[model samples]
Target: MEVKIMEGGPNDPACPLMVDSSQVTQISEGDERDVVQSLVEIIERIGSYGDYRRTQRKECFNLVRRMKLLAPLLEEVGEMERPLPEEAIACFCKLKKAFMSAKKLLRTCHDGSKIYLALESESVAGRFHSVNEKLNFALDDMPYELLGISDEVKEQVELMCLQLRRSKRRTDTQDIELAMDTMVVFSKKDDRNADSAILERLANKLELHTVPELRAESIVVRKLIKERSGQNSETTQQIIDLLNKFKKIAGIEENQGYGIDNVFLPKSLEKSPSLLIPNDFLCPITLEIMTDPVIIATGQTYERSSIQKWLESGHRTCPKTRLTLSHLSLAPNYALRNLISLWCEKYNVELPKKENTSLGSEGSSEHKEEISAVVRDLSSHLEAQRAAVIKIRLLSKENPDNRVLIAREGAIPHLIGLLSYPESKIQENAVTSLLNLSLDEGNKRLIAKAEAIPAIIEVLRRGSMEARENSAAALFSLSTVDENKVTIGSLNGIPPLVDLLREGTIRGKKDAATALFNLSLNQANKLRAVKTGAIPPLLQLLQDKNLGMVDEALSILSLLAMIPEGHGVIGQQSFIQTLVELIKEGTPKNKECAVALLLDLGLTNSFHILAALQFGVYEHLIELVQSGNNRAQRKASSLLQHMSKCEQVP
Candidate 1:
């Protein structure tokens, strides 16, 4: 069948007959044909719906070319032979006539009287232009009203306009799918504005669902919400409803992961007035909403009522893990600490600074004023600072500045009270305070006078890293005076400190090493550490991946290994074996430390001699002897000489 462009009326012998069955199937079959027809019609209209209101002549030539391109495909779909080359000229001529006729009719704005003329005419392109111009003009304002028309009439007219514009744009299948999806999602929203203009414009280029239909869906959901929203238990029911809707959606992933708010609300509400709970309870640090608010040590749900109990214990949550904080998990800046700081500031409080000490010369006048100003402020806020100080006393470790303060004349008794607080930060802080106070001769005598050593040592045995480190530092400080050294050694601090050497964190390990180092300065503490299995861990730590830790451990081990018992410990265990391996395999600095330690340990045992010889520790020592680092050469030579002497010692 030949494709025909409608002219004026049914009188034209060239009047085209659309394959009625094909057109009907394309319209209602709701398959790919519907998609194709809908798309083709939209494109044709956008292409041919020329602007007629312009006084200047605008080109509708592109629209003609577009219609000509789609005419062949429409013909092919009707199972007609492809239009002959001659049919193109006839189609163009007929289209031009119809559009011109439509343009003339639109001039009257006669209530779509022009549309009826355009549809009825077979030979007049004037009718086509009239309908196109009016739609383009009307759609330029309100589009939604046009979309709300009856589907039957809309689909038929839309198919004709779209077929003409289809050739204007070569839209891809993906573009069509995206356009469909965008229409589906956006058209469902409540839009009450001049949507007619948009819908009319879209009718020219898109298949947006009617705005009225969208509003109807919203009305349905709103009715449902009205019927259900009055119940007191509605929020929980709403969650269930939302989840059910989610589950009903086809192809939703089965494992969507847990919902944070849904799981936590019941227990959280049971424990506290729900009003006190923020609608969104999120951790400030993590920024995600909180779940499973566990209480540490107290075994209670963390809620408004339990928050005070946690604060009293000087603990806060793990910033990363979102777990209930204990001494083991507390962050550096506990929320309570900030709370206390805010409390101090609110009441006009100031924190104390360390004692004003000049580095070299006597105080300048400017420095003196600064110091005096600080002291005055500290005095004014002393109560608040003391409160903060009291809180710090509860920790198992003392921050360095706090340690310095406790060494002053009056910080001990207040620190002692926190040992019973059960919070490790408090206990640690108490230990730190004791450490500081022990450093001063007067305070040391006072601590001994108060018999604080036993209590301090008890914490050393069971306290957190902060507590142990501070206690160790304190024990070191106390032993600076002879009586205190004997006092500390007698309290069984060596075994615990060494135990910490094996199990402590890097900082804890460092503290343990330093503590042993301090104790080694006193001969009894040196023997005690060597007797308490400190050598192997210290030796192991000397090979630590952390260079600074390695240096500190080696220095401590080097100091302790000078003692006879220390020498025996190093030789008897694989301490010497590990060191010999380190010397053979380690960097020059490590080799130097290992060899120096071996020399100090005297290389007496058969295991020490055999391992050192088997591992070629002597060869590395010789290489070190040739190096320019005088320290390495000296230590290496000393090690070789010691190995020579070990042969005679046994």
Candidate 2:
């Protein structure tokens, strides 16, 4: 069972190292500070993994010590008031990737199978060495002088680097001995020839003495094999086979042992280990695996792009918690991200690349020039104008910078003119281009201020379905500004939007509903919408579950109920009956909306209250008051109080 101890060189955790210079992509300087801070936070969490991986304690200690030295420097740079020099930022970006790799390795040590890990000690040690070398590589190239760091801290960093350079060439001898013992125990041809004493010692060390522990570690090993993306099938199968041998040695029967510890750290991690897709891995909105999960203030994680879109659409509450977020800031969830990355690796799932959402930040000089040329073509002949607008549409949707460049290139007025073109293609591309451009927050006011609202409204009234959809979307995005809401309402925008909401395709209807919702926020526009036959279709949408818009319809009706005319229109017996039914049979949000609408209706119309009372609405109201959410309970109580005030009539 004797084996020679290996020296640390290429696989040495103590070797001085440098990351490949080419892997250092230029990160946006504006984001580098936050990224550094995030790295610091993740490293802090990684420090806690020392409690596990007793076999790899030496490697874990080395990793934690190096990170402890790196954290202060990271925080110092993150807190610098002056802009970080481009060289330092580049170095930090490279370090960001390296630090994330270190984190993944550390997480594996904590979550992976102890027996499999013990058998693969050299590989695990090599991984630790790799991360350390990357760290050394990053720090060695870092420009400490240009970083504006204090001399005392600079010397400490220099010492840390020197420590890595002088690291004694040695591997954990205990891990080496354990691996030899395991191999000798398993390599024997006969049970009598194998060393049971050595096997017993290995099992205790691997924490496989109990049936449940052996079974759990086996599950962990299988999970590791599945998640170890890009590994050859032969290698994965070998690891799985080794795991089964250990389980057989431990005398545990399949399906008889207790599985993953029921005491999971978070509710998000409590899914059965056998499930291919963990429930928490999915974005609540998209219901797909999240590529870039972020934590909202409510401590709920969601796909970053999805939640950003939700915030942009003017929703201020957490999607799952339904509580108003204290602030709009989204913190990166490094723990969840590592967990998801592991899950994706196990399944060999290729996650989508992280998109650069901060457009115009990249070195997009070529895009700027090309977009300028394209914007000029908007004034060319019909064919050229159509071609130019198509290019502009793509450019505008691609980045915020393109939208800025397009506006500056004099494409806005040209696009506004094309919005009225008799040619449906040009009109569709033009309105759609404007719709794409309006995604930029600054462009919202620019688009509305350029006298484009009137033309956009006209397109909403008569263009093709796609054009009308985009027109409605543009109006909705633009109407975020208070002045644009008035401008749109004054230009008779509400009628066309209401028309689209009633008659358009699904996307068109969604766009129209959103625009009408935004426009209806204005007191004057609410009357405009209610008077233009918007009520009938909105009410009709209540019973149509397939539209998934009962809440939207109720929201609009609630706003209109503030006015006498809209309230009278919505006070019809059928709509009140529908709201009552929803109170008894809807989702939590549906019940809340239904209660609010009924409360709104009864504030001025005693007949509506009498109608609801006739339907036995009191029982539902009492139930909601006792068990519904805060909003629903308050609204329901108010409805009951209002109903109680109404006197008997002959």
Candidate 3:
């Protein structure tokens, strides 16, 4: 399409230089290794621009400097031991591709018609400006958390993107003036000889006044036309027309056989060296992101169907390397599957559906018989016991009614026994099964009555991460029954759970916090929790913004603060400062909790009230009294009244 011009300049149709879609870099989709290597190659290519006959050398060097800054981040990505999650690989690919296209544009500035370049100097700036915008887009697309990028490198890249965004409005007066003068020469079409001195100056400006220089210019413009093959025809034609004018002024002739016939074959750009699957998320066989990934004996992960198909086809080998397999069994790759799930959720891509296995009601007598098998085979083959408990876990997970049936069939006691198993997976499956069974109210009582609380707490202290996390969950579920809460606390469950809350995974911490929250609801267990030193972790969780535990921490602290031990530990000036911060910056619910906690503290100690005043809490209290929620308003007004009384007394 002929772009509309702004009525000046011979960069014919110097419209905002609308980027041609064809100019967008097309990165061939590759596997994890290829993705990392592509990033390295693109960075190298971008850095390879020499100082050879380059226009806008400063801008080109600036582009190189920006790309070099990203190399440290790429090196970190390359050194990562784990495969880059599919989404992170995609981000790297996008960043690499953007730099690749920018490299090509920079190459044009290095070797294309210098007189045409000097003429369209503003357009040259626009090209540099355009690539920076592309880079900004790629950087904005990546989720930094997916990659293991260091804070320093991430900050540098972020700052680079900020500069690129701000560079859009940058201009150069010299380029603009030179561009206008060159346009005037192109405008005087018939009066070609009328500006020999102008042509001499243009030739001098571009170092193109010599015959050999004229010959080289003709050859380059011709080569560019052949390379373009007429895509950027108007720009190439302007380059041609300008080159020919210079030739006429230099008493030289255009070389028709300027080696355009050889068709300088560019190297193949397919860049195919590895797996056809696009990324780590994809199954090597199916070439799609695996919803249910499984690892085979060869230690290769593939979608469930891919593994099934491979084994079904009588191929006893890993599809990726075609290597011989030691065994045909496939294990669930829970870790990669989880990563894929997070990637899908982040990108808002829906997972493909699997057949629904969740029955609406309890399984029949046959299923009950299977539950007996778990109890019957409790001390049998380890694998069989594991398989049985996993079956029980799956059944219990299907529905609440099924859990009642599974518990009645005497699987809970055996599952709890298996929690002490030596094999980690069996222990994980067993504890998880008990956790599932404990979801039913009756099963919660039975599981607690079976002396399972100590065993579950043992697993919480030393089981596999999944097992420990599930033990905490099981504790939380069982603690839901008011009677079981006392049983759990009496079994010495509160301390290990407090430890898990202090030093566990985010899920484990959440589960431990919830169990503690429920157990603390019982007055005696509140003292038990306090004695176990739950205050420090609770305070840590309150300060953590990413864990989403602020509300729960405040609630638990508010409850514990009602007692003397809680008040002693939680009523410190630092804790009070955190509450005041919450009142100023937290959500309305958070404000209400902070206000209530502060009011409780202030009613007992004048220091907390005065500290509130000293921390500049009066205006915040005034704002809360006006616009806060009803509970917040009431709490704030009461606190204000308390502060007023404190001021009068002191």
Q: Which regions of candidate 1 fall more than 4 Å away from where they truly are?
A: 1-409, 436-442, 585-588, 603-607, 642-650
1-650, model 2: which lDDT tens digit per residue? 11111223435433222222332334344565666786788887897775667788776777778778877788788778887776676576557767778888888788787865776665676577667777787787789889888887888888778877654233123443354355544443434211333454466667765544654565576566556764765555555555554444433222222222321112333344444567677665544467789898998888787777556534567766569989888888888889988976786666766656563223345556777789878888878898998998877764444676788778888999999899998899899888877755567778877889999989988899988988887887677667888999999998888888788886677677767876887889988888888999999889888877777677778778889989899988888889889999998878987997787778787899999888778899999999886557667866777777898421
Per-model TM against the reference: 0.37, 0.46, 0.44
Better of 2 and 3 by lDDT: 2
User: Residue 249's C-alpha lDDT in candidate 1?
Assistant: 22
Return whichever of 2 and 3 wins on TM-score. 2
lDDT of 1 by residue, 266-318 (tens): 33233332223232343222222233233344232332222332233222443
Better of 1 and 2 by TM-score: 2
Question: Which candidate leads in TM-score?
Answer: 2
* Alpha-carbon local distance difference test for all models: 0.46, 0.71, 0.68
